[model samples]
Target: MTDPDPFRVIFVCTGNICRSPMAEVVLRALAVQRGLASRVLSRSAGTGDWHLGERADERTLDCLTRRGYDGSAHRARQFSAASFAENDLIVALDRTHERILKAWARSDDDKGKVTLLRAFDPHASSMDVPDPYYAGPPMFDSVLAMIETATRGLFSQLEPAVRAPRTTLRALRRPDQEDLP
Candidate 1:
């Protein structure tokens, strides 16, 4: 049988050079680790266009590499009102981005899609994932750690839901069509 549609998720931050890209990479890696990569499409964008077309910060790349996640191909893009329709979830690195996204929403459903990344992290002490752009490498690593923790939590919650549509579709197939591709 054909595969089901992948669940689309986009991470948003101030400039797309630090936190959001890290969250994107972390979440993608987690989905792959859990064998849900085919059922989840992860991406990232900035709340502002200042860094559009630029790669993630060097520190962000280094931290991701040290942890075995790839951030090499990330290019900055801005989140727009149009983005609300493309992603199933709009994850914000901080409350500020969350507010911006929700305010840009055209409907209640679109507004509801916006959430803070740390909301998934049960042990998190803050809702915001701080930007490490001007900070040293150590701070970048620390931020990445926060992203990894929250992303793992997010992936765990999404796994079963990602698999549900395929399972239901297969069950609804006729007995005679079970062997059909």
Candidate 2:
């Protein structure tokens, strides 16, 4: 099979302190659980730079910790055009983030990559994943739940593309084995 191309995904929100950071950790953990860590590169960012150098909110960290996710190393960062170029999918936590990303998008292709995170979930017909930063701990839990569900759906959509390259590589190797005989 041919070498697999890394599938890059960036989760975004208003400030990296809360939702985005949580999404990043959750998605990373999910990828690891599915044995897709080496096949995918998941990260997070914010539309604003308010917490650029700060760690995730204490409440968010605590919530994630309770769920067995480590958020100790999460440092907030802002999304950039460079990130858009690097990621295959740029998932926004809400419509506001989607707008910000769309505005910053350099081309039609870039805009196409930007989408609401909830849209990935077949159950989230509402299209918005409410921001939980201001609403406190319970809100964080709700956001986490939605993100977990969406990530599961996202993985389902991505599985085929992720495996295609590996399949091609195996096909190529089979021919090489025949020549060795």
The lDDT values for all models are 0.85, 0.80
lDDT of 1 at 80: 86
lDDT of 1 by residue, 1-181 (tens): 8888888899999999999999999888888888888998999999899999999988899899999988999999999888888888899999899888888999988976787888888889999998898889999999989988888888777776787875543211111223445
- Candidate 2: list runs displaced more than 4 Å: 1-3, 166-181
- Alpha-carbon runs more than 4 Å astray in model 1: 166-181
Residue 120 shift from truth in candidate 2, angstroms:
1.5
What would the TM-score be for candidate 1 when compared with the true structure?
0.90
Clashing pairs in 1: none
lDDT of 2 at 120: 70
lDDT string for model 2 (112-159, tens) is 788777777777767788877778888888888888888777777666
Please report the TM-score between candidate 2 and the true structure.
Answer: 0.86
lDDT, candidate 1, at 164 = 86
